[model samples]
Target: MLHTVNKSPFDSHSLQTCLGLAKAGSDILLIEDAVYAAMSGTAVTSMVESAMNSSTIYALEPDLKARGIGSEKMISGINLVGYDGFVELAVTNDKVQSWL
Candidate 1:
């Protein structure tokens, strides 16, 4: 499955909730404000790191750049994807779930 989370972890638990229930080997795509979770050293960094153990995590590159989070600032294991990559992930997964 592919999980897409667009909310900021700072203001929403949707990211955490998604991570908690995500299937093993699924992919999690962070879009919009949720890209903040991809950065290292944040309050939710541990959660993000933990999720990486079970899931392949990614952040939308354009979204991260818009929020002033460069690829260099993201957590080491997180992958950065553009619009095309996002579409690719969506197609690769068996299903797509968007966390509000």
Candidate 2:
């Protein structure tokens, strides 16, 4: 399963949902302003850890940089994937859910 968190409430809630499922290959994508959710030691950060520890997680690099978040400061387990990676996720995942 995979989820994209594009809004704040959904970002928080969807992450919580993913945590419970803890699927072997679950993924959470933080894009748009959701990229800012990667700052260390926040709700989003904890969520990032929870999802990544159990499955794959990624951030949209262009969105992060566009918002002034450099790639170096990204949270651990949160890889910076370009458009190609995003497309790959879409193609590879069994299911994709958008949290907006």
Candidate 3:
């Protein structure tokens, strides 16, 4: 999943969706402003952590830095991946979907 939402409302639902998929053994690829979830102490942060506790989760690097959430500041488990990483996940996953 390439979650692109930036707002808290969107993050809540998007984070939940990612966690649902992850609990089922799926991975998540967050894009655009969704990278904020990688930050520490945010609502989405805990959500990402829960998802990661079960499955793989990544955030787009460009998105993270664009919004000022650098890799150094990312919560413990959120992996920051590049564009090539996105391609890899798309090719490796059983399916792909975008969340607005």
Q: Which candidate is the best by lDDT?
A: 1
lDDT of 1 by residue, 1-96 (tens): 999999999999999899889989999999999999999888999989988999999999999989899767888989989999999998889799
lDDT of 3 by residue, 10-50 (tens): 43576565456443556677777667667887655666676
Q: What CA root-mean-square deviation does each model show from the true structure? A: 0.7, 2.5, 2.7
TM-score of each: 0.96, 0.78, 0.79
| Candidate 2 C-alpha lDDT tens digits along 1-100 | 6677765433356545645665677777877877777666565677666567677778888888888887566677677788898888888888788765
Candidate 3: Cα lDDT at 63: 81
- From the highest lDDT down, the ranking of the candidates is 1, 2, 3
TM-score between model 1 and native: 0.96
Model 1 regions more than 4 Å off: none
Cα-based lDDT for every prediction: 0.92, 0.71, 0.67
Question: In model 2, what lDDT does residue 21 have?
Answer: 62
lDDT for model 3 comes to 0.67
The better-scoring model by TM-score among 2 and 3 is 3
TM-score of 3: 0.79
TM-score winner between 1 and 3, please give it: 1
